[model samples]
Target: MRAISVIVVLAGVLSCRAATPDLRFGWNEVDYVWDSPTQRESAIKSRHFLPEHNLPLGLARWKNKLFVTVPRWKSGVVSSLNYVDIDGAKDQPLKPYPSLKDNYVEDTAKEIPSNSSIVSVFRVFVDACDRLWVMDSGLADILGSPNQITGPSIVIFDLNTDKLLHRYYLKVTDMKEDSFFANIIVDVDNATCDNAFAYIPDLGGYGVVVYSLKQDDSWRVSHHYFHFEPLAGSFNVSGIEFHWTDGVFGLALSEPRENGYRTMFFHAFASTKEFCVSTELLRNYTHIDKNEAFHDFKLLGDRGEGTQASASFYDISTNVLFYTQVNRDGIGCWNSNKPYTPENNPLLFSDAELYEFPNDLKVDDEGTLWLLTDKLPRFVYRSLDSNELNYMIYSIKTKDLIKGTPCEN
Candidate 1:
């Protein structure tokens, strides 16, 4: 039997106890830039500029610019990838990364992938070599009615020059039906840049697809923990009750061990349990490890009741794991040096309103912890006030986040 200890906290008090800094940027609804005046006019004339329909899902930072992803889950998402200037005005409209031509378009001719055009993107990651790894879902209208436009692929770019490096489409054998490539992490050292590997989570298919840059091939891996926990699917955020069955939605890599392979900590969006596997095992796509794979994957432990998390990042500086506490409307941390349990893990800060439905969380190269909250339940089930802030981004240095707390070493 599992020991389940639940802590009941008053939402009002949690909201007051939040110490996170003010929102860096927020909007009633996000806006974007176009290639030209004609393109802007065309987008508006065709009813493809519905601001409220676009939803920001993923984020990554490279130096002075912060990259944000707006998935085509509904109509009116003109660009799938954009960036915000850290020194620019607050709530400024986002400019398309690279150019609007590289993003999505509504034309029938644009439905196919034409020389670097992206259908949609859900996640982006920047490696130590200053390369931005983009997970192009090749999908559109995912929230209302998901549609596959192009084959799922990874598009990488040289952040220094904003030039394309490589684009690899997944092997058909690697992508199962309903495979939603929602998140990705690039594992590569600066010395071995050409021999890189990417770990992508198939949230819809309940498996992870590994890609090799050197071999230019991909393979799929599965474990029972990739599936969602049905008992933990129920969610109540801001009085909006709903259920989610997303699987294997979060992945965080620790500093490399003595053997030079890192430990990957992952969790399902609909489950409270955290699990782990070695990078050495996942790197070998050629191996069929049905018998060996079972014992290779280990369960870390449950995070606690109603503590299902989304995006996670393992800070090498503090040897801590920071995650978005979705159900509790807060931010949480766990000192990886200790065991993964309720007493060892703590929800450091929470706010019923400010942190409502926190979606994406990331730790940038500067040791800053960034978070993006969309109040998604209100937007999906109820209605968002056009004049009220619905989507927001917040950031704070990791050192300050765990200075005196037990999260620090």
Candidate 2:
């Protein structure tokens, strides 16, 4: 009887353990095979290939389309927006249409200063009246002077027509506002107001500036909102993203000094205020020590002094940060200071554990994650899960994607 009781107790404990749910949160590596040779020479010799932008800064997805922006070094501009269509693919490797001639008509480039480059795409929303707002940070002089702008501001693009709608310049009459307005979060679909709100993480401005999207016919600010926190030195707040499920937004902040550390911030707004009252979601998150994690690298300063800079993310129902960096060996991941996973090492594309600097990443409505890789001939596609730990690439149809099926079929 004693032996039986002991066996029954052990069995009950095992059953309870098995019944508990497993929690798996985090990204695994994926590999993709392409019909086109990844060799730059082959692709270039085949067609009128544009320069592969290795510097990925921002990404946006809407209406079954993916938009990616990369810094253009030769042109001294940042209008490298590539559109990918997952709907039409004949072979296993989906062909990429790098030009606007295929689907949408191309428009004239709205040029900024020669040193200006797009840091990231903050928001992509079709307003109730039908307008697309693109918030960006413009540099007066990146290599020359640090912050010499009226200030980096937001630029709006009309989604239906792909035209330059408006540009919002940040300034104050008396003060010299050298704002590093790099990232933003827009609640375009707020329940309360006809006017949408924009939260700008101005690294140099030292706080967030809130703005209303409702504008006059002349493209002027009819009414706006601003929030600044002088005590927290809110200036270093760089990367901003929205996590809908968590009921809050996330901000990746850099240290004030060049040699200082970084943190992950959470901004929760009171629902009653319609997200008006913003407070720190997670203050000063120094989870990873700067020294141990980055000990292998010495900051790059050859052409320009490489500072602690630039970040992107992969939002798999949650936010996972992405950016580029140079390993100790001197290989540059767009020269940004994004973290490198030990399992997903940098500088290779396949087979072995390789890490490609994802300057921008997004998950379309269909649950497919798109990554804009920082390679010589920059690559873009949906990452297919090969197994629990491994990922592969594929170019599939939109119909199949919407149905939650892999395009390989």
lDDT of each: 0.82, 0.31
- lDDT for model 2 comes to 0.31
**Clash counts for the predictions, in order:** 0, 12
lDDT of 1 by residue, 1-409 (tens): 0000011123234435544544677767787876678877877788778788877778888899889898887767888988999777557888887778787565233265465777788889999899999998887776666667777889998999998888898888887787788899988889999888899998889999999899888888888989999998988889888998999989999988999999999999999889999898889746755787779899998889989888998888888899888889888888988888987788887877677888888898778888888887887787777776677787888877776677878
Model 1 residue 331 CA deviation (Å) reads 1.0
Residue-by-residue lDDT tens digits, candidate 2, 26-105? 11321112233563344346422323322334555557454444332222222334433445221122222222222111
User: Which regions of candidate 1 fall more than 4 Å away from where they truly are?
Assistant: 1-19, 107-110
C-alpha TM-scores of all predictions: 0.93, 0.41
* Window of ten residues with lowest summed lDDT in model 1: 1-10
